[model samples]
Target: MSFIRGKKVGGVIYYSEVENVRVNGKVVQKHIRYIGRDKDNPDHIPIEKVHFGYIATRLMQGDLSPSELFGMIEKIGSHVNRENLERIGLFYDFKKNSFSLSLYRKRLSGNQKDAEDVKKG
Candidate 1:
């Protein structure tokens, strides 16, 4: 379900890890992680970068609770995206136009504010 995709643009080859998913009965390919360009050694990918898809998979498997998941997301900040969760096997019900994480909002919101306050101080 996951594979490498490569594209060449102006002599630079870029690659990404992609996953296939079914959306509205249509199979769509989504990018998981930007693996970097051929010009740059992919093996040397930065340590600071966290793959949200992998974390999402852990959360889906219940290996991490929703509060832990949200904490990781807040730590990663902008790097998190809906696509990452979908690639990790989450699905969106377009008819409902909703996600199920509302159950976690109450659990995580308070802790998140405390974390923010600690960071600010």
Candidate 2:
């Protein structure tokens, strides 16, 4: 299962997604995705807002379970209201207690590309 991990470097904390995988008959942690820096720091570089599509994609790929995804969302301080979910081609199924992508994926206007730049720096 994937979960958020924080590593400190040069007195700054950087967070990312990581999971355990079997490698050469040994279980090891593999880096999944770079999330962002500690938001509480003054020098923190803000990354793009987490969208419903990202969560849905990860969920569908089995990278994150429902509870893990929700925990990550809560840790990141993201808002997951119904209107916001529909805006990004996602919806929460109350019956199934899970999130699913909609037929039409609506792209939002924002600094979606900024996260890549931040990761590079």
- lDDT of each residue in 1-121, candidate 1, tens digit only: 7988888889867787789999999999986655555323232121221343466568668798645655664564423322212222233346644322211012236677698679879
For candidate 1, give the lDDT of residue 102.
16
Q: Please give, for residues 12-115, the per-residue lDDT of candidate 2 as tens digits.
A: 68787789999999999997555555322211112232455567568678787645754655566653332222222355546545443322223444575475
The 10 consecutive residues of candidate 1 with the worst lDDT sum are 98-107
lDDT of 1 at 43: 20
lDDT of every predicted structure (CA atoms): 0.50, 0.52
TM-scores for candidates 1 onward, in order: 0.34, 0.34
Candidate 1 stretches with Cα past 4 Å from truth are 43-121
TM-score of 1: 0.34
